[model samples]
Target: MSSTALRRSLLAASAVLVTAGVWLAAGTASAGTLTGTLYRDTDTPVARWLAANPGDSRAAQISSRIASQPATRWLSNFNVGTIESEVAGYVGAATRAGQVPALTVYGIPNRDCGGASAGGAPDLATYQTWVNGIARGLAGRTTLIMLEPDSIALQTCLSAGEITARDQALATATRTLKAAGAKVYLDGGHSAWNAAAEQARRLANAGVADGDGFYTNASNFQSTANESAFGRSVLSALSGRGINGKRQVIDTSRNGGAAGDWCGDDNTDRRIGRYPTLDTGDANIDAYLWIKPPGEADGCAYPAGSFQPSLAASLATGAANPPTTTPPATPPTTPPTTPPTTPPTTPPTNPPTGACGATYATSSSWQGGFQGQITVKAGTGAVNGWAVSWTLASGQSINQVWGGVLSVSGSTVTVRNAAWNGSLQPGATAEFGFIANGPAGTSSLSCSA
Candidate 1:
């Protein structure tokens, strides 16, 4: 899609992008990192929902599925009891492991620009009440709070008159949280999604003056180079607005590399970072964080609410293990096995434009094997293996494979264990092919091929 069309779609998604949160540290350290999701100690509707269901399911699933989007990352459905317990678990783990955990709080209202990730405290009054409870849970703990992800920037969807009231509430929340002693990093969305000036203006207007600064690259990838560029611009704007005194953080969670898509579509599986460590490359940038748990859905990319285990494994600490090797073959001259392939078919189509209603679409495609092509350009940087995964609508099989190994499970296809074209640079393109055979009229395209 044209950049203009992409921006329009992003602005529309700005409403939903407002829906999440993240965490980081006060000082820099070596690369290994600690990260965790915030869960309430109370066993409210959300806890009840997770308990009753199994395997990556949660109570928010009902509303989220019905809305055809992700459930707001922050919701009050978690009771105080759950909050306390969860916080204790986080604190305890951090304390014991000697690692700080990155956490996000999303219970704020109108998250994600009213995208599928909407919902929050009923109003400012109620949100403050919830904040009080959250503060109590966070008391004496050293944790970074990604305060109200999309609340500030995405508020344009609100009626003009209501904007002041919204800002007022945000100011109040910022003060209250800061007073409670929590280190708060207000989300600045990603580098590509919001203009620096506009982001700074909204943040300043929303009272970021009282904040620790802003966060960028949260759950989106525009590249660290781009993010740093974008962040400095936004910070410059914020400075102009008199809110530049604070530092900023970026969600380095899944952005080991960059692609245009949101989900794991590029599936580059760059093992540049694990938990707590950040390579953000900016001193004022504070820290790079894995705020978004590796492998968690940006929302169902392949199957509704299903977690991509391979993708998850690739992201998790498991990637550190040594690879297994086979013993020498009986026939010393035997040729090695050829990688998987399918009969030739249609070449890849260009990537589609606009943010589709489908959850986690960006991160879930092969990204036209662009990720593999990244290093080809530089020809000098270290190159690692690659993996790409996607879930077909069902009844689909590998029509062809080029440079990578292909594995199938039910409706999902994972590309691993094959030769990638060349070293992948920050933003490269790659493509794979597939053909679906289902009942007549059942095999319609779910999105751009």
Candidate 2:
């Protein structure tokens, strides 16, 4: 070959090496990547409806209800046409800004398997159509996709006949999406929700062998330390079925802290946590994903089926986004008296308060029960009856209460000390508290009245 040709070949090889190096460096960094569903700012299905009718009250109400539920909205939002555009914009901005924002693709039918958290495609036909659109949205993009969360592994709650149908639907969805050139990860629930063998069997039954690998901890809180072990076991089980991957990825969404309960309404507390990291114990185990978006209510801080602005603010802080640091130290115990702050009694005429206070405490505890005490001091006038109301974020409900009368209204939790027990003497203070389960890091005291 001529000298010029030899030089050109060497240059080409050097370029390839440079690209590989960048990819490798990105993989090893301590900063965890972000990954979750891409959705439009609005919360409605007509937003994607084919008919495109101008207005329909029934559809409007359904959309409003579904939009209120973050999980449902997270999954269904992909159906909207604008979602792809939003993601495209984010990718461009991140690329220009020199960052890689990991992303996930949810919105499968039968998500969460008919539980209180369940909402998905209307049917298999609708799901297939939606999948195609999502693939189009992702075409030429570099965002990671956590496909069809909880659709395959959590099917145990279905009947035998229903399971068969769901399996076919999931397999079809996975194959169709993969064909669209989207890398997909079927949710395997979490280490705590299902055993390795069981999850593997279900995935196999759902035809996960056709996809890249399965995902775990999408929205669940199985610890990374525990999820890695569980992931390997599932991978080993798949080994017998001839799946080629060495390992799978797990979600680190709310796993920075301990695990939360499966079901408890008043469990509306939020906790600050680190972002998703790539420190998987095994090589085959891919990067950890924030499949559950920060600021999206987990039914605890938000309404049972809605998003809470206060909760979303708490999630935006670095403490929960790409969790690298530990959350603020929770008060060891409820202080005997309110910290001496003679601030005005009127509510702050503001939105997006800091990550400390009653809302933050209750929203923080949505994942774990709150352990604290509140003393209600009487104002200048003689105090009449007292009510200690604890309103949960969207989707959260009252798990348990002590020392007061507790009432639940959708996502609002109220604890009232009745008239018989209501009087507070002038210059005297009334004290009460309740051990309540909520989301991770919820605001504790809304009203000390």
Cα lDDT of model 1 by residue, 1-449, tens digit: 00000000011311211111223323323222222222212212222333434365322332121111111123223232345445555544543433333346665545454343333443556556666766666554545566766666566678886778777877776777667555566768777777889888887877778867777765565566777788788888887866656666766545554456655633655332322233334456655654553444443233212233444444433233212221111221322122101111112233223211011211112211100110011122333444445565544344433234457788766654233332343233333222223311112222111
TM-score per model over all chains: 0.52, 0.53
Local accuracy of candidate 2 as per-residue lDDT tens digits, 1-449: 00000000112221211121122232232322222222222212222221243254333332332222222114333234344554555444433333333445554545555343434444556557666666565454443456666676666667899888878877876676566444556677787787788888888888777776777776566677787788778989989877755347666545554467742223334333334444433565656555554334443322223333333333332342222232221222332121111111222233223211232222112123333344455554556666555556654444433334668776666666533335655444443333444443344566454
RMSD of each: 19.1, 17.3
Clash tally for model 1? 49
For TM-score, the strongest prediction is 2
Local lDDT at 233 for model 2:
88
lDDT of 2: 0.46
